[model samples]
Target: MQFDLNRITRKNIQLLKPYSSARDEFSGEAKVFLDANENSLGSPLTKWYNRYPDPHHVQLRNKIAAIKGIAPEHIFLGNGSDECIDVLFRCFCEPGVSNTIICPPTYGMYQVSANINNVAIQEAPLLPDYQLNLAHIEQLVNADSRIIWLCSPNNPTGNLMNLEDIETVLNNFFGLVVVDEAYINFARQRSLISLLPDYPNLVVLQTLSKAWGLAGLRIGMAFAGMAIVEIMNKVKPPYNISEPAQELALKALDEVGQVNDMITLLVDMREALAAVFRQMPWVEVVYPSDANFLLVKMQQAHLVYEFLLDKGIVVRDRSRVELCDNCLRITIGTEQENTLLVDALAAWHEQ
Candidate 1:
C-alpha cells in the first residue's frame, strides 16, 4: 500500500508545537551554564546529577544507532518500551476516535496504553498455535486503525511471529505496523529494524531490560521512519530519560560482546530448562520459544503456580490469558535458579 505519513498521523499531532527546552535552544560546550534555573551548586549527593539530562538523547541514540546499523535520526528513546507505546498512541491515535489493532496473548501494555490514551482497541487474537491470525487482523483493519501491535518472540507464549506474516501486514496496512521486539535479543530471527528503510510505516520497539540486564535502567527504543521519530519526539516529555539511565545505557551499549555471551548462555539454559519441563509428568506441553522464557501447559497449572509460590518461587500464571489456559510462563533463570525450580517441581510431584 502507498504509505502517506501525514495522512495517517493524528490531525492534532500534525499541528503540534513541541515544547522547546533550554537544551533544545542551545547545544555544545558552555562555561557558566546559567540556563534552566538549576541548583548550580549541584545535588545533595553529587554535582554530576545537578543538571537535567539531555532532552534529546543524542549520545545514547547515536551509540544505539551504531550498534543497530540504523541512523540516529530513526531512533526514539523512552523511559521504557511502555513509554514508547504510550507516545505512539499520543502521536497517532486520536482519543475516543481513532483505534489500533492488537494480537492478544501478546503484550498487555498495548491494550493498557490504548486504554490510558482513551483510544479504541481492536483485538485480532492470535490463533491457537500462538501466531497472528492474519485474516482476522485484515478484517479488523479500517480507516480509523492507526497502529497494529505485533510482539515477536511474543511474551507469555515466547515464540516469534512468522516474519512473512508481519511483512504481509506491512505490505498491505496503510497505518503503522509496530513490531515490538523487546525479546529480540534471544530470538533467532533478525530484527525488522533492517526493514525500516523499506517500510516507512514500520516501528520496531526494543529494550535493554532483557539480555542487557538493565531493567532497572528503563531504557526503551523505537526505530521508525524519521517522520515517525520526529512526531514521537515532539510528543514525548523533554527530559523523559534520566541522567544516570542515559550514562548507564551508553556504557552498556559498549559491551555488545558481553551481552551476546549472556544471550548465548541464556538461550542454552532456556533449551535445557525446556527439556527438563518436557520430561516432567505435570508439564502437558512446553511451547517452543525463541525468547528467554518458556510457556508450559501444565496439569493443575494454577495449583502448580501456587505450589511454586509457596516454595518461594514465582512464574507467570497465564492459565487465564486467552489461548493460554492451564499455562505458566517461566523465564530462564541462572543455572542454580533453574535447578532450584526443577527440584521444587519434583518435590511438588512427590506430594
Candidate 2:
C-alpha cells in the first residue's frame, strides 16, 4: 500500500544523472537550428530527417495523454513495450541479487529480459483455468523480489487476468506490478491505466502493434506514476523513437474511428473463426478469448502445425507453452486469410 520508490529503485540508478540532450534544455519554436550539429543541408531522402528526433517524444506523448486522460509526464514512449520492460529491470533489479515474479504461459519477453539483466526469475504459473494463482504469487514475493509481471488478454492464452486478483497483488506487494496490456484494445474490459493515480507501483504497458496496425512503426507506451516514468525516461537511449514512427503514430491516433472499426471486425472474425474451429473434429478445445486471437487445442497439434506451414499459411505453434499443451495460437486474419486457413484445415481433414 505504501510504495516508496526510493527504497525500491537501484542505488546506482537513484544517483544516476541521465544524459540530457540539447533539446532537453530549450523547449519552444526556433526558426534556425544550430544546436545538435545537424547538416544544414536537408537529408538525401525526400522528407526532412537530417535532424535528430525529439528525445522526449513531446508531441506524441501529449497526443497520447489527451486520449488516455493522463498527464504527458506520466507517459514514457519506448522503441517497443519490450524496451520499457528491459528498462524496468535495469532501473530496479540489482543484477544477481534482486529477483522478479513471472506467471508463465504468459509473455516470453519477461523471462528473456530478466535473464538478459541477470535478475533471478521466480515462476508462479497460472492456475488450471489460466487465471492468476494469487496465493502462490503472494507467497513467492520475498524482500528481494523487485517486480511481478502480469499479462492481460494474455498472449497464447487470450484471456484477461481478473482485475480483483491484480488489485490484491498491488495491495500486498510493495514492489512493481507490471500489467502488459498489449492486446487491451481488442478486449472488452477497461484498461488499468485509469487506475495509475490510485497505485504508485503500477505500470501499464501498451503498444500500437496490435489493433492500431502499426507494428512496423514500433511505438509502445508505458503509463505509470511520474516517478517511474521519469526514471524510465532517464535510462532510455536518446531518440529511441524515430521521426517517421512518431509522425505516423500521431496520424494513426487521429484515426481512432478507423482503429475501432477494425477492432470490431477482428473481434467478429475471431468469434467466427472460433465457431469454425469448434466444428472441426481435430480441434479438441477452442478457449474463450477477449483478444484478437484464439488459442485452440488440436488433437495432433504438431502435425496440424506442419500441415498449415506446408500450405504457406503461418500460425503460432504454442503447443510447448505451459497450460497450452497441443495448442495453435491463431490471429484473427482478414476474411480471405481466415478462409484460406479454414480451407487448408478442411483439406487436411479430407486427407
Candidate 3:
C-alpha cells in the first residue's frame, strides 16, 4: 500500500492549531509570572505545583535525546506510554473510518486503546512460535489501517520478535509502525530508534517505568519523525508530566550506574528463576526472555496460580492467550521474593 505522509495525517488535525499557553511563547528565563492563571500563593502540595509545567517538556526531552542518541525534536513524552499509544489514534485515525492491526497474545492495551478510539482492530496473530507473522500482517493492511502495534520481547510471551520481520512490515506498510519497546532496555538487540530516519512512519515507544524502576513516576517516551510526533504533541494535554516526575527522572538519568547495576542484578535473578522453573516437576517449559520477567509453562496453571496467590506471590496467568497454554507470566522479584516463590511452588507440588 502506498501513502503520502502529509495526505494521511487526519484532515482536521492538519488544519487545527494547538492551544497555546502564555508560557509557550517565551521559553527563556522568566520571573513575576502572570501568564496562565495560578494561585499567587504557592500550593501546599509543592512550590512547583503552583505554576504550570513546561507544556512541551523541553528539558526532559533533551536529556532523553542525549541518552538515546535521537534529537529532542523527535521525542514525545506522555503521562505513560499508554497515552502516547492512545494519542496516535486520535491524531491520525478517524474513529469508525480508520483501523489498526495488532498481534494477539501481545499487550492488551493496544487492542483496548484501539477499541476506545472506535478504531477497528485487525489481528494477524503471531505464529505458533510466538514470532510475528509478517505475511499474514501484510494481508491485513489496507488504506484504513493506520497503525500496527508490535511489542518486542512481547509482553506475556517474553520473547523478542525477529527484527528483520519488523523491517519487512515497515518496508511494505503505508501507516505508522508503533514498536512498543517498554522492555527493550533488558533486551540484547539494538533499538529501532536508529531506524526513525529511515522510516517516517516508525515510532519507538520507551518508558523509564520498566528498566529504571520508575513505574510510579509515569514517564513514557515516544521517538519518531518530527511530523508524526507533532500531531501527538498537538493532542496531548499541556502539563502532562508533573514537576516531581521531571525532577526524579533527571536524578535517575544521573544514576545510570545504579540503573545498569540493577539491570545486571535483575538479569541474574531472571536466569536463576528460569533454572529453578526448569527443575520443577510440574513445569513443562520456561520460555526464554529478554525482559525482567519469565513465562513459565506448567501442568496446572489454575491450581498453581491460585496457590501462589494464596501465598501472596502475584504472577500473571496468561494461559488463555493464544499459543500460551498453562503459562504463568512471572516478574523476577528480589532474591528473597524469588525464594519464597520457589518454595511456594515446591510446597504446592508436594501436596
Tell me which residue pairs clash in candidate 1.
Answer: none
Name the runs in model 1 displaced over 4 angstroms: none
lDDT per residue as tens, model 3, 1-351: 574667568898888898887777766787777767788788767454776777888888888899889899999999989889988888888899998999988999998888899999899998989999988898888878888999997898888899999998898889889999999988888789999888888999999999999999999999999888888898998788988888889888888889999999999999989998899888999999999999989998978999999999889988777888898999999999999999999999898
Q: How many clashes in candidate 3?
A: 0
TM of each candidate vs. truth:
0.98, 0.98, 0.97
Candidate 3 segments exceeding 4 Å error: 46-48
Least well predicted 10-residue stretch by lDDT in candidate 3: 43-52
> On a 0 to 100 scale, what is the lDDT of residue 93 in model 3?
85
Q: Write the per-residue lDDT of candidate 1 for residues 1-351, one digit (tens) a residue.
A: 477898888888899899989898877798888888988877678445988899999999999999999899999999999999999999888898998999988889999999999999899999999889999999999888899999998998999999999999999999999999999999999999999889989999999889899999999999999989999999999999999999989998999999999999999999999999999987899999999999999999999999999999999999999899999999999999999999999999999
Native-vs-model 1 lDDT? 0.93
